[model samples]
Target chain A: MSNSTAFSRARFAALIACFAATSPALAQPSTVGFDQISAGDTAWMLSSTALVLLMTIPGLALFYAGMVRKKNVLGTALQSFAITALITVLWVVVGYSLAFTPGSAFIGSLDRFLLEGMVYLKSSSQLSVSHIAPTIPESVFVMFQLTFAIITPALITGAFAERMRFGSMMVFMALWSLLVYVPVAHWVWEPGGWLAAMGALDFAGGTVVHINAGAAGLVCAWMLGPRSNFGKDAFLPYNLALTLTGASLLWVGWFGFNAGSAVAADGRAGMAMLVTQVAAATAALVWMAVEWLTRSRVTLLGACSGAVAGLVAITPASGFVNVVGALSIGLAAGLFCFWGATGLKRLLRADDSLDVFGIHGIGGLVGAILTGVFADKAIGGVDSHLGVQALGAFATLIYSGVVSFLILLLIRSTMGLRVTPDQERGGVDLALHSEQII
Target chain B: MVHDDKFPIAAQLFIRLKRSPGRVIDVTWMLENELYALEVLKVARGADAESAELAARYETLLRNRKPGATAAPQQPTAFARTSSFMAEPEPVPAEVGRHYVGSLR
Candidate 1:
């Protein structure tokens, strides 16, 4: 590693060590004593955070860039990289504390602004234990959750791919993260929040990440209108190889995503990993078979899209459901998401540039609802109601949709949202960033 | 809100270009706003070796055009976005002259 990289590694090690020693938590009444912190679980969570971050950078970036036309390739990828940095800044400044700290049923406070407790950490050797996660250090949990915060809004970029001013997108993501992602995250993940109190199950962010991004993506698509040549033009993907590579990375990294949500390297994590695999495989086959029947040929794009569908569908059910549940959800996700991308795309007529609504949105909505049905109590010791799951799904759709629409409008009014016809024709990469594949 | 019809800008934003069968060069944009027009030109050229020379020429060209002159639509620039494998550029309106240039793709 380079000197800077080595220094960062050292800095991170020190921080983790500081977090490992939970001196402040001894005073709090808790089952897991402050004397004990699981190094094994901390190690896993740390790795999981890196994996999730990877999902966005090269993984998600390559996936989006490959799907867009050659001119739009770099611009599409740039959004993901830009969001990762933007969200990280927001997360440290106030996002983490507001979403995770105690305040009301809907939102948290600025008590931990700038990650105050984390950086200084009360004499630099001690850290507080979050009520939600008793075994792992709060620092570990915070870093892990921050990764989720980064990717949610980044996923929405797929909607208004070739259009959308970059400045408008940045502003939209910043506001959306604070207004939409933070509140929803608090509701589902934070123990004191409404959704958690109501016993809604989101193993790894079906509602907060996928559903929220998908809904926002739909609204953004509607707000931005279609790409200039939507109905008339044939915009073929620039590269399937890059997309396939990205999808493969997403599949591999997802073990960390689902299993790591367990917050432990225990039996639950093992089962979560197993279910993830089962569901992804089942969904891929189902999507391919359906595509073959429909188009008389099974395209590679269908297979990759299928895998992502399964991942999104199983995300909420990963911890609650059994192997049987995984298979069922995966199969359903393949069939449903296939329809979502094709039938729904035609029905909506909105140029969701990358099927964000059709795949992630539809899949997440279905996944959340199905979690209620497939959430076998005997397997994961959690029972779910179908109504409650539907409530969570619709709640996210309404909240993200309305909020995202307003954010987009605000951005549009302020600094012109879409690029000019000249810029669009020139390609956003060359036009905006002055970069091209050549 | 600078409406095209309501508020006529003193400068005419028009690109003057020459194109051969396979290549295009010496594209000059005449506009009211010098800095902004140069910014757009820089975006397309992007730190190329010839960028400085081409920009200087465009600056000299823009100086010649009188302000508020109506610009007829120009032919598509020769170096329009084209993928090696894909023949046609992205589709737009029926206008802009070139249609389905890349017949193979």
Candidate 2:
């Protein structure tokens, strides 16, 4: 065998050994039976699932909606809602299988397509093994994860807004979810996937969600050329109030996003929730401070954006680091993202429109790389996984960027990337819907 | 020229002036003719009175004066001959001032 192949095999063996060594023993049946699950845990999980769904449906949707010009508000909001609905159906049909089903080392097969042979009544199945809370029904876990799948592609839409055709967006989102998002999610989260087999642990979705979505967003932004008014006129956000509200919802919903990854109502989940809050708070303050020192004012919009950067940064490491690690990550994310959103984006000349790549993509990368440096075994039960984490992160970045670029090119060649200049100036809402925003 | 009654302020002012016997007909006619000429010039040129006055003064100066030796603006010299002619301000009657002051109070 080639050296790389042998190395992969050895790494896979080490992962299996590690899992076997640390695996918790199956609890024996008590006289009280499986009814011992705390009511608090069930309540928290149920609420968290709703919060995560909220993050995509209205949180991200309205956030992006308010960022675009007034003419495109309804179109942006409608597209987000549509993607949420579409992904929910797709996840039930085939997305879940490709992401979570048991298969080879690369990807899962179509055994669970259309959710065939999957019973909702049963609490335990092959699918349940992937979750920390095996007692919960696999259907619940699938629904919770489907929200993540929905938001990842929705995040990319912000990069190419105000110009892309609605039909092309639908096709691109469907393909991206299937090819890019699913494969990466599997590699990071699935037991048999290559990255997981290499001992990479993403507590939430630092690599899988933020990095994967951010890279794709950057590629899409580049492929869909700058807006017609770019550099010639100002493209300020139309409504800061709407963006503020959306950002606040994102902040609240992120607890569910990070803590819910634990899949159990345990000490680990509690720590994850605490660290996520601390990081986000610190990052918001730090970002506001930077803007004040540099720009002579503390803008509400800046604080909100900083909070999101913190959330993105802490996503991968929330489960692995202590409060100090969370604080440091937050500070770095605040400063780096301010630079990315303002200075770097200005230099690059790509109109990311909403800073999707700057905040999500760059923040996710920072979080993923730092997770290697700060991951402590005492806190998260992740030990000596730094090298594997770096490999997983780099692999995600390359795959996502390249695949996303190719997909964008294909879409551009076949259906065209940007709308006509007239259509864009008139607004996508009117162009596509034949109706004005009320 | 006949007076138009549509503009009461102008008609009243003209009637009051006509009743004042001490008013000079030659000077009144000259002023009236000059006012008519100014109005015509204003309409034709689409220029306000301020601009028209500046243009008239510039034309008069150009027609009557010689070029300066240095090709610069002509400087007023004490040795130059001066015309005694001067423009006068319009006068208001004592009763008119009293009535105007009464209206203000």
Candidate 3:
């Protein structure tokens, strides 16, 4: 480790020590004293949880589904909806324990496994609270984090959209959530984890959610190969209107995603919400301007895509940066992500079907690095180093990329990864699900 | 008549359209029709190679313009033709007038 890394670790250790000494109740992992709970924090967190979940099912589902070809619309939407259910179950089982609880420097313990220690005693008005969010009930925190878990894998589906077998996708996602997502979440969010110890500032999952999914998505696209007639024929989006609606919902719900990360109903959360809006709007306009300049005519799809790019890029910086930082991050995200989707995409020669890597992966990276540069110490109450931020972002990318590829390879050897060519041509909606839109 | 046995996909599409004769034809209808039409033609070409050759020739002919249609003197640029302009190269490419006109297929 470098000198900066060591300094970061020392600083983080001091902060932890200070917090532990000052508030023993907050540092303890097992149970929260009922008196320590904040009803206002709990209420906001509950609302935030619901809002974040909205970003997945109807939000991401519609967003992805609108972009796929009509034949695969239902199947594509089903991926998001199904992953929502799948990750919810997995998070409750062991994923929450592995990600959020205290353990070794790399992974969390099984103390919360099957929610073993979590308690809700209505008669005594007692409930469990995570060390991570001492003010809010642990149940609320789990649900909020579960929403994040659901969206990450759901985001990956965009890369291999309209190709993978449904059963194989389910299996691949299940393994990926455990092996890739859980570990990365622990590394970045859990205080004892290496990245956190190194003072990586991912206020709202730039490394954990966006970059992680982006890398995995690129791998899935490479492994699955291109959709049939990919370059030969125009694979136009089915409906831009649905896409706009989804993007709109994602915009609104991101308040919960970023602000909710604060784990409190406080000024920091308010700042996060404000910065998120500024970044998203700036990125959207920049993207539209770039598209108008390059492609000549501005399209609704391009506008929607630009807005999403902005949102993805602003995610990690929302809490740490002010409006000025948000604008700069959004601008950078728009320009870089446009190239990623177009020029970089062609250069990589991978058929990332819906530009998942282009937008999410690239946007996540830009946000993560810029967060280091633009993070206001006064606002965030912590100084961030650029090197540490880059380390966390690139580390997650490489780790997720390699692990996702291995998982895909394992699945390929066993049950196979893609639908048969005939089934694909006939449309997975009918072939796999036995349903199709007229 | 397109037979169901010969061109099942096209035949099915035709039946659907026929059943809804009052349906408003739109871009989606054209797009789907074009897709199924190509599928039928692909099968036909597989059975006999001349169909492919004829289709290629027809595509070329459709793209080619009438001889000497642009023989009349014209302005050098769109701005020169539409309004007034200084003699300078425009930074942006024109949206139309490519030598090779490719179809959506």
The reply for model 2, stretches above 4 Å from the true place, is A1-42, A122-132, B1-105
Error of 2 at A331 (Å): 0.7
DockQ of 2: 0.01
Residues A272-356 of candidate 3 have per-residue lDDT tens digits of: 9998988888888988899788867676767777888888988998889999999999999989988888889889988898889
Clashes of 1: 0
Scored by DockQ, the top model is 1
lDDT, candidate 2, A19-100, per-residue tens: 5533223221112223534456666677778989999889998888877767788888888898998898889899988887
Best by lDDT: 3
Off by over 4 Å in 3: A1-26, B1-105
User: What docking class should model 3 receive?
Assistant: incorrect
**Model 3 deviation from the true structure expressed as Cα RMSD, one decimal place:** 12.6
State the C-alpha lDDT per candidate.
0.78, 0.74, 0.81
Between prediction 1 and prediction 3, the one with superior lDDT is: 3
Error of 1 at A69 (Å): 0.6
Q: Candidate 2 vs candidate 3: which has greater DockQ?
A: 3
In model 1, what lDDT does residue A394 have?
A: 90
**For model 2 chain A, the run of ten residues with the poorest summed lDDT:** A24-33
TM-score winner: 3
For residues A1-438, write the lDDT of model 1, one tens digit per residue.
596576557545544543343231222212344456788888898999898888888889988888887888999999999999999999989999889877666787777888776532434445566666777887778888888999899889998898888998999999999999999998888765667656778889999989999999999989989887666565667787999988888888888889999999888998889999999999999999997898677878889999999999999999889998999999999999998888887788788888998889998988899999989887678768675688788998999999998888888888878999878876898778765553
